[model samples]
Each structure stands twice: as C-alpha cells, then as structure tokens.
Target: MARGLSQPKRIVILGGGYVGLYAALGLQRKLKGNEASVTVIDPQPHMTYQPFLPEAAAGAIEPRHVVVPLRKTLKRCHVLTARVTKISHADKCVEIEAPDGHTEQVGFDILVVALGSVARLMPIPGLAEQGIAFKTIGEAIFLRNHVMSKLDAAASTVDQELRRKLLTFTFVGGGFAGIEALAELEDMARFATRYYENIEPSDLRWVLVEAAGRILPEVRESLGVYTVLQLEKRGIEVYLSTLAKSFENGHVILSDGTEFDSDTIVWTAGVKANPVLATSDLPLDERGRLKATPTLQVEGLPDVWTAGDNAAVPDLSRIEEDPSALCAPNAQHAVRQANQMAKNIVSVLRDKQPRDYFHKNVGSVASLGLHKGVADVYNVKAKGFIAWGMHRGYHVARVPTFNRKFRVVADWLLSGLLRREVISMGQINNPRAEFDRVSRS
Candidate 1:
C-alpha cells in the first residue's frame, strides 16, 4: 500500500478540465517533498476556461489568454495530452489512447476521475454537418470568423436571397452558453456592420429558439424575462417554448412551422456527462456521472475521487432541505469541489480524516454584450451596466493563474481604447484548402 513517507505514491488524474487542472494544482501545493508522483492526462495541452468562451467568440478577449497551459502551469506534474479510454479502479489501471492512435495501460496508486461533460447534442437531421458547438476555444474562434466572413460575402454579393440567408443567424439553446454567445456575437456582428457599405444592423436577423419557456434558468425567472426584453429591444427574435425541428442544408424548420434559411447554426442546448464514465468499473448515477460522496471520494472506493460536472456529489447546503439535492454540474461548484478534494487526498496520505466539501453557491452573473448584463448573486439582483461589470469582475478574478488574468484584463482595456475588431480570418479555418488547390494546379 502506498501511504505515509515510505515511498512516493503514483497519482493519476484524468480529464484536465476545471476540476482536473485545479485539483492537480491543489495537490501539487499540498503534497510534501516526494510525497506523491503526479500525472495529469488530457486530450488538450491546455485547459480552456469555458466561462470566457463568449468573450473570446466576440473578440472581447484574446482566445489564447483564456486557456491555461498545463505543462507550464503544473511544473512538478507529468502532463500528457491523451484520452483515457477506460478506468478500472479495482485493478488501479486506466487505458489511455494517445493522439497517434496507440493505446497504453497506466497504473496508479491513487486515481482521480475528473472527466467532464460534453455538449448534449440531439438527433436532429443536418445538425451533424451544419451545427457548430460553442464549448471550446477552437469552436469559439471558428464562430467569430464564420460570422464575419458571412458579412464579407454578403457585402460583395448582389444575390439578395443569399445575402439574407448569410445574414440570418439562428441559435438553438437558451442556457447561459446560448444566451451569452448569441448576445455577444450578435453585438459583435452588429458592430461589424459599421464598416460595411450595404449591410446594416437592421439587415441582420438574429433568432433564439429555446424549447423551455425561458432562458438563463441558472439565474431567475424574472431575470430570464428581462433578458428576453433586452434582446427584443435590440431587434432579436426570442422564441420561447419552441424547438428546431430540422436544419437540413441550413433551411431551418421550427416546431412552430417557422421556416427560414440560415448560413450559421450554433447548438448550445445542454451537455451530458462524458461518455467515458460508462466504460469504467466505477459506480455511476443514472446520468452516467461518477457517484461521489460529500468528501469527494468515489462511492465504495476510498483511493478513488471524483468531482466536477462528471461527478454527482450531494449538495450539502441543500440536502437537508431536499434529500435529492446534488451539486449542479457547473464551474463554480467544480472549482470549489476540486480544492476540497485535493485536501482530502492529502489527508488520506497523512493518515488523517478528510472533510466534506461544501459551499453555498454565491450566485450567477452573465454578460449580455458590451456594458450590458444581468446578475443575481447572493440575492443581490442587478441588470444593465451594473450586472455587466459584476460579470467581468467575477470571471477575471476566477480565471486561473495571474499571467492569464493580466492578459485578459489587458484585452478588455485595449478594446476600450480602440474600435471593435471587424477583420475575419476565415481562411485560417481552411488553411489547407488553398495549399491543396495550389498543389493540384
């Protein structure tokens, strides 16, 4: 058994997301000299702070600044850019698939199941080919370029029908992601029109469709209503209790029989726990999340721990009032849970009792656009400029390392002094296409 000061324990952390990255950082700080050998495995070399994805999409923040490089940040830990195919806690071994198509079995004394969630895509026709997800930095950058490129094409083309289709943007989802992304990009696209000779803000059609009756359910019902009003005030069409029935060839068909052609389609409805959990021997809830205790340890397994969006931890603050209360799969809870989980892992190493992770959610704040937002933190409700400031302040304070925070702050500061960036590098998305054609010629 790996314990105490006898020898270094081999520790492996899966999924370098908010939980995996932060928990590893915590463990690195908490562990004594040579107490444990830490290894972090993830498909990406960096952990993208998803909260700033909207800002990145809208060019309010540099895309590179929002992601924390794992190798540079975790100097003492082994960071591997690979995917975990399987987890077998009974044998304490995980199957890792490398990027080059090779698989290897990695053994560890301590295992952390931090694999996060993925975009919950529906089985809508044409979605696979046309729908874009807004979860990662790549997708965010693609959206910024795609939207602007459409505007460029529209400006040069005299085809009225094609121009209308290019200008029509449809977003299917009303959660924080869908709302913030739609708001910020719409704001950016509107700002971009200033440079175009023919295109105007009024010429662009922005549509938001949510099957639910309201958007931003993470906030409050009242705030959701206010958001609709704000979007409508900006000439955006907010369709609540509506669903996108189909999107074959960008010809959108809604449940309400609203049909229109759009060149851009963004899907941000919801997410399911990472499907990797199903392949593991660990106990999982109905939603395929790892079953974890309040102390952040995997159910029925002491050496294994789980947290974040992938773990169904009991909501300590609400469990007494509601026994069914489980922590929501969000960044706020994930970061806090990871911090506590790190301490728990260290306690076990030193033969001490671990404490349960608990923190009442402070609140949620969302940016609508430049100088516009809505927030409800600690029941202190706010809207417009006040809420926008709160949203920026909260995220800037929470975005990982000091270096990244400085850069992000500088991005906002510089944008204030200059006009919004309207240039589109759409060619970057198809950098190989031009080269391939040149080679053939």
Candidate 2:
C-alpha cells in the first residue's frame, strides 16, 4: 500500500488524543521486533485527559499533570507535532504541515483516523468573538486566569455597574463540561472571596443556560434534578429550557427574555465530529463521522481503522434493544474503543481475524466541585460525597499511565490540605504586552 516498503507496514495515526495515545501504547507493547513501524501525528505534543480540565481550571490539579507527553510515552512510535492537511487513500499518503508552515507527504500502509471532535458552535451574534470554549488545557488555563482576573477587577472597581458585569458569569450548556466547569470555578471563586476585601460569594452571579428541558442527560433524571437543587442552594441560577439568543458586546440575551451583561461567557453546548473527514477519501455517516463496523474497521475501506469521536462505532451493547445505536462520544467509550482497535490492528498484522468491540453503557458520573458529585453506575444511583468519591476513583483508575494517576491524586491531596490557591496570574496571558509597549515608548 505504501509503494512496496511496507513489509514492516507503516501505521500512521492522526490526532494523538485518547485513541491515538492508547493505540500507540498498545502497539508498542504488542508488536515485537518491528511487527509494524508505527507513527503518531497530532498538533499537540501531549494527550490531555479532558475530564480533569475542570479541576485544572479550579486549581484542584496541576495543569501539566492532566496531559501525557506524546514523545515520552510513545517511545516505540514516531511522533509528529503537525497539522494533518490531507489524506489520500488513492495515493496512500497523508499531507501534513508543521508549525514552521512547511508541508510534506508521508506514505502509510495503514491509517488510523482518531482526529477527535471539535466544539459544536452556532452562528450566534458575538458568540465567536465573545464566547470561550472549554475543550483544551490551554482554554482551561485561560478561563481560570480570566475568571480570577474578573474577580480582581470586581474587587478594585468602585463603579457598581462594571463590578456587576465583572462578577456575572454565564455558561451556555448543561452537559458534563458546562456543569463541571461552572461548578468548580464557582466553588473556587467563592472560596477566593475570603481574601477579597469587597467581594462576597453571594455577590457572584453564576448563570447556567440550557435549551433542553433537563441537564445531565447522560445520568439519571433524578440526579439531574438533585444537581439543579444543589446549585440553587449554592446561589447559582439554573435556567432550564432556555437558549443564549445573543452575546453582543457581552450583553447576554436569552430566549427566556433574560438580559444581562457578563464579562465571562463560556460555551460548552456540544461537540461534532472532526471536519477533517470531509477532506479525506473515507466513507462517512450522515453525521460526518466515519462509518465503522463493531470491529472498529472503516466500512468498505481496507487498510483504514477508526475510533474515538471521529468513528461512528455501532453500540453492540445496545443493538439487542435498539437496531441503530452507536457509541456516544465520551472518554468512557473512547478509551475502551482505542484498546480494542489497537488489538484488532495487531491481530490483522499477524494475519488473524479481528473481533468486534462490545462494552455496555456502564452509566455516568459527574463532579460538582470538591467533595460533591452525582453518579449512576450499573443502574445504582449515588449522590453527594459518595458519588464524588466514585467520580475520583473511576477517573484515577482510567487516566493513562500510573505516574499521571499518582500526580493527580497527590495534587488532590495537596489541594485538600492547603488553603485554596486564589491569586490571579492574568499577566501570564499576555506577558509580551508590557514589553511591546515599553519598546514602543
């Protein structure tokens, strides 16, 4: 497939997220003495464990601990920090551009499409310029620094109108990302008020806007109700069945006719499959995800495999009950899918039949800041502190590499023992601004 030098077949993986990282790690272990030459390519040098991003934003975990360095971990594979420009199955090659803006084509005998989903954004007025998305570690750090900066601004300002705007934080989504981000940040900000001379926890107005009738659709409906109650008890406003109509100049207008000015507007509504699929010669489903069978092989396409958010893997666990059920785009599914996909890849390399992936929806767990959470595992429901422990235990076990797990646990322990870290490092966002101004002067 790669023009005759594929005896040790060239395996190229796109997007070093959950699937890429895990698949490479699996291959490194399974393929002995050059069973196949492996390569992994992604824009970022590390694979971020996204579930911990909220805690990273809240200062509960160190930002670096949540990401695994690709080069260090994927030792047996070639790691490339480059953007994939194109994939040509007919040519059996992929075009990539490095940070230096140079492009080149790399031939591959097998291709792994794991370019995960992107934020599902809509054309709302001012949303693009004003809305902050919660996807990457960079965004989490930015949000944290920005939120703290707002607190600093609110404390120093004498003008009530500006203070009100600075203190109001509006989150437009009620899924796991939105709820966790809002909850952790709100909790941290509230704790920070202890040091502020003027600001109070009650003075902060945290608003959650969801168009759906209910939030946390991944969990039990009763748990969703409980989460709303807990947030309400903490003085957070929950606007269910509402939409963010506009965010013109930070003037948030909701479908429910609620209008307010907020300095912070976060969008975590949903995610769509990566748009890169449209550029490739791969079979895609109606939703723009790769059409994959239960075995994680690209439908009707030889030498191509897919998993994670980019692959529309049939939910074999649900097929008995529902004919058209596909795996949801979550870490729970992504991680397991990668493990299975890797083994299947190795099996095919050794000239063996591949097996289908099957894992039941084990249920979901969500953290509502420190020591508070909700969980529904195996039809059993949990709430409050116990659920929070479950949330911590589950993720600590699942996060790749024991080193990262230890660090995350240690960070949690250290955070619990010490006072909440409350200082704002807003200057970090633009360290060169002052330098530029001084040079101009």
Candidate 3:
C-alpha cells in the first residue's frame, strides 16, 4: 500500500511479459501519487524482449541486454517475483506461490489477467528430455553454447557416425521464432566453422521441419515462398508439410518416412495459453483463453480484464470479414491492447466508460540472418538486406525504454567492430563442479 493514501485502490497485474509490463508502466504514468496502488506479480523478475532472442543467440546482441528488470523498470509499481497459482475473481483474491515454496493469498480491487502463453508441447517421446526449446533468453543462450559445443565435439571425434550426428542441427517449426533462430544460428555456425581447423561449412547440416504447407503464415504467401527459396539456397533443407513423429534417442523420425540421427533438436512449434488459467474462476473459451470483449474487458465480469496471448480478444478490425475473428496473439496486438487497457482502467476509476480497442494490421518483418530478411509493410514487400534493416530498425524502436534501446544499438555497433563470440561457455551449466573438485583436492 502507498503511504498516506488511506485504503488506496489496489490494482494487480499478472505476468511480466509485454502486456503486464506495459500495463504497469501505463498505470504508473496515469495514476496520481498514491491514488492507486499497483502490484505486478510474475515468476521472473525481468520481462524478456522476445523479438531479440534470436539475435542474442546468434551473437548479434548480448544476452543480458534482452530483458528489463521489472523492479528496476517499474519504479512506482510493486513488483512481486512469484507465480500466480490460482485466480478467484469471484472473491477478488489470488493465490500465489513464492520462490521459497510458500503459498499466500492477496486481495485486489482490480485485476488484470495477462498471464500470457507457454510452449505448446506434444506427447512425442524423448522430446521432454532431448528436444531443446527456443523460447526464453536462457534457452537461447543454452542453444548457442550447445551448438558451438557440438561443433567442438565434432572436430575432436574421429568416428564418421559420431561426427555426422554431432554436426547435424534440426529445427521444428516455420514461424518467425523457429525460422529466425534457425537461420541466425546456422549463419553463426557457418561463420564459426572458419575458426575450427577440422570443421568445414559443408560438414554442418541444418534442417527446418514445418507441418504446415508453408512457413511464416503471418506474412504474404509469396514472401513466405521467397523465404523458403532463400533458405534452400544456403543449403538449409526446408521440410514443408512434414511432421516430426519421434525424436527418441537422438534419432529423428518424420511423417514423410525420413529418418536421421541428430545431436541437436530445436522445438518452436507453437504456444498455448498458460495452464494456470484452468484453475481460475474466470470464464475461458474452449481453447483455454479468457473470453474478453473488444474493449479488453472480461465478458460479464466487472473490475477484471485480460489481454495478450491468454485472452481471446475479438478482432474488431476484422469483424466485417469474419464475425468470429479474434486478435492474433502477437506482440503488436499485445502492446496496443496494454495501452488501451490502461486507459480504460483509468476511465473506470474516474467513473467514465471504456472504449473498444481497434487497430489495423500494419505489417510483419522477419530477419533470416545477418544482412538477410523479408518484410511486408502495408502490402509493400521487401526482401534481402532492406528487409533485414527494417527488421532491426522496427524492433529497436519498440524494445522498451531508451536505456535498453541504447544498449541493444551499442551491441550491434560493437559486433561490427569485433568478431562474433563462438567460444562455448558450457561450464556455466555446472558452476559448483569446480568448487567441489577443489574442496575434494
């Protein structure tokens, strides 16, 4: 509670992704001193700028610069690093599990459900144990080190079979994340091979598997086709309409009856709403997303709102074309929705009615690798270096605070002056091992 504000209006924002972070920022800006107390609860202390994860993994940007610390960023808002276990909207309270494994309940006058989504995993065997994800900053860093380590292993191995498996990298997905990560890391690996005396570029195998007929459905089909061609030109095998049947014991079995042994399997298939929503009393759609109105309010639920990947917000911009159309769960929509949601919350506080959220589909841009990309803005298509420039330019402009923007830009400038770091710091995974060894000695 804010000091000197007797019984300050409590406003709680869930999750620390694009929606929650921006909403908290908006509230802090709009609310007067001690007018409303804001609390943001998330499992992590920092909010990741997900769009830059690929670049970070590829050594284009430093990993630590890709996330904003919630506590440091939201100065006026109370930031709690905890997982929301249950949301009882009816009772106007939420149950949270702290980092220390303690559960506690907190009451809120207003609630914002922005729990976001989680990686959608399948029942594929060995995936849980073997397949690495390309979602978080940690995963990106891990994959970078893991990929380089594989090359090191391949260089040292004399066995042909072992070398072949060690040099193979398989990516499962065709979306922006999957494509960008695969392309960027592949470019990195190709460049890094020049430093390794035994490893040649041709020795590395990069494969992309997408169950869909085409990749990058967010962009125009023609652009997507062009992307596929560009990828294939670089010796990347694009498997369209192919499913990864099993990844058991480093052996990849595809629905196309293709079988291969790989040491690295990257999964970026899709994402589903956070499973915690299942325990909430709020109304949810069949797909587990919260039912939200165009105004970003939960239907028939006062003082409660939802947005981002976890809410099925009606797409007013597409209602004429498709009456049942819902907003695409992307950062573009999430940012805009958070701004509008904050405005609406302020309106309700002042006894004013809220307005609906409507934004036209601007465009989409994707970076294939350094100096390579494809973009479509307002039906205008751009490919190659121009698109890559646009991709970096657009993201830098939207990547949160000016402090972070400066650091990310500085990283890009520094990368131009220095060589890409390819050394695998795999030892970071087991920091205590050295201490244990020294203690025993």
Candidate 4:
C-alpha cells in the first residue's frame, strides 16, 4: 500500500548478528526520510551479544538479556525472519527460505553480505554426533542445562566410572569462548558441589585442550601465561599443543595419545565464514571470507559491501606490509567496521566522500568466574577480582537495548540475593516428546 519511485534503492542485509544489526540500525539512522529501503534477512529475529554468554551460562545473567530483538531496534527497516539459502550477485537476487518452508527471491540495489561465521567443525570422526558448539542462544541455554544435569547425575550416581565420566568436562579450543566457558562452568560446578550429598569439588576434572601452544592468543603472551596459571590454580588441566583426534563413542582420543571419558565435550575450536559465501559469485579470500577493503566495500562489486566475520577487511593500522594482515574476526572490529560501513553507504548515497577504518587495539578482557578474571586494558594488565569487576562493567555497558541491559543488571542483583539454581531442564533438547513411545504388549 506504499508507493515510491518506480524503483527505489534497496539495501539488503544478511544476518541479524553484531555487524548486521549495527550496520542496519546505523543505515536506518543515516538514511532517515530517504527513499532507500533497507531489508534485513536473518534466521532469527534478534542479534545476540556474545560477550555476555559466559555469564549467562554460569547463571549470572539471563539468556534472553544477551540478545536484542532486531525488529524493535530497527523499526525503520523491513526485518525478515528467514534464512538466506543462496545469493546470485550477478543477478542481484537472493533466495530466502522461511520457517514455514516457503521460498522467495528478493531483489537488491546494494547487497550487504554479513552472513557471519558458523561453528568451524572439522572432519574428525564422531564430532558431529558428540560435540556441542557455543554460537547460538539455544546452544548456550542447552549447555548450561546440560552441564548442571551432569552435576546432578554425578552426585546421584553410585557407579564410580559413571560419576567420573559425568564430572569430567572437556573443552576443545583456546579462544575466548572456550576459555571463558570452561572457567565459568567449572566455577559454577565447584560452587554447586556444596549442595551435593556425596560429591566434592575435587572430584571434578576440567580439561582444556588446545591445538596451539597457548590460549587467549588475542591477549599478550604474559596474560596468556597468567590465564593458564589461574586456571591451573583451580585444578583445571590445560593440555597445550594437543589436538582431539576423535570423540567417537564417548572415548576421547587426543593427539598426545591421551584418552579420557567425558559426558560433556564442548567444541569451541574456531569459527569459519558461513558456507553461504560459496553460493555467491563474489570474490572471496583463501579462507572463503568475502574480500573487502578497509572502506568495507567488496572487491569487483561496487554496490555490494561486506563486513564482520564473513569479510576479510584490511587492517589499515597494521603497516606490516603483509597482504595476509587482515582485520581480526572479533566483536570490537565488527562494531567499528559496521559503523564505518554505514557511513560509507550513506556517503555514496548522498554523493559524499567516505572514510576508511583504522583503530588501535583497545585490549581484551576474560572473566574466569565470579570475582575472578583477567584484563589487558590500554596495555595495563589486571587480574583477580578487579579484572572481574571491570569485565562485568564493560559488558554491561556494551549489551544492546535498554531492556536487555536492565534485565542483565537485574539478574546480577538477584543473583546476590538468591542461590545459584543448578537444576537442569533437559527435555527441551528434543521437540518430539513421544518419539520413543512404544506399546508394552
């Protein structure tokens, strides 16, 4: 029922993630009262702020507070709750499939390929069947419930082997997700053991396996060493320079010939660009990420732009003279890039000059658990409770939307008044509740 020019400039944004949300909102603000139409297509209607995921898992914050609904945030844009199946850049059309199995093609004047990264799974046998990833809200909630369920199972069981296996938690990878998740969950489990009749915190075995020699590589080497020592102090086993060959049939085989039985194996090794990139004819880097300049424009595609984990934007700040020195795939870079991309899009629309992206590293922070963390802010190393407080303060300010921020703050306050609930709701994992139903006769 709306009429405009015969054809208006259509800005199509894929994925409602960190980069996509920021870019869409920024565009909506910049293009106010313009004829340009911005349509954002993502499988989910919300954008998740992943920095708070560890706290959510540790029951320090509610899961819903960590995600911002895109429709509410981007009211001026058309929000499509659908998964992008394919893109024909040559034809300037995209194929989208909705939740109801309906498919449609949408035309675009300018395309923003922000289809973000997915769990970078390997060809290791049995990983698909036994491992869990930490990318989605569902995964975070399910992991929290699953971890608590393991604790309950361990405490209630009399079988020593089963108890040991239930208490044995293995996290594969050394990145922020892996390290933070391991630290938070281990702390939660340790705190929960006080309620168990027969279980002790010492009975639990927390193992971190990283293929690389160190963890939290984004931080300085000294900080990484400090992280290892802090985790070790809490009885966590750090297996560096190791790889998980397979987790087939509940038996975990490591490259170092070490084997373990664990009921929980969380794989946070790394993330690769979404496979959706292959469907498009756009230029991609060796890692399959869209080739993009610091200006956030895709190569050979004037009207198309890409950023976030899917785009390999050049690091203008890094004057190493190496072509391989691209921007790091992180929230910090994604946010700054999205803002710059939005500005460039508007500049081009208004026939103005756009600017490039160049920002110095602000440093990193990792929360180990309640009152325990590590941070390197402005080259100043901080650890213990002070770092933990800074971690909470930093993320609380970064969480998008007032609703989410208030909810997260409320969760933190309520947590102080109430004991951490360790119960598990495992039934939601399967939708078909009666799938196993059978006749007794």
Which candidate, 1 or 4, would have the higher TM-score against the true structure?
1
Residues 236-290 of candidate 4 have per-residue lDDT tens digits of 9999999999899768999999998988999999999999888788899899999
TM-score of each: 0.98, 0.98, 0.97, 0.96
Cα lDDT tens digits for candidate 1, 377-433? 998899999999999999999999999999999999998888568789999899999
User: Taking the tens digit of each residue's C-alpha lDDT, what string does model 3 give over 364-402?
Assistant: 999999999999999999999999999999999999999
Could you tell me the lDDT of residue 5 within candidate 2? 50
Clashes of each: 0, 0, 0, 0
Q: Is candidate 3 or candidate 4 better by TM-score?
A: 3
TM-score for model 1?
Answer: 0.98
* Rank ordering of all candidates by lDDT, starting from the highest: 3, 1, 2, 4
Cα misplacement distance, residue 20 of candidate 4 (Å): 0.7
**Which sections of candidate 4 miss by over 4 Å?**
1-7, 320-324, 431-441
Clashing pairs in 1: none
Better of 2 and 4 by lDDT: 2
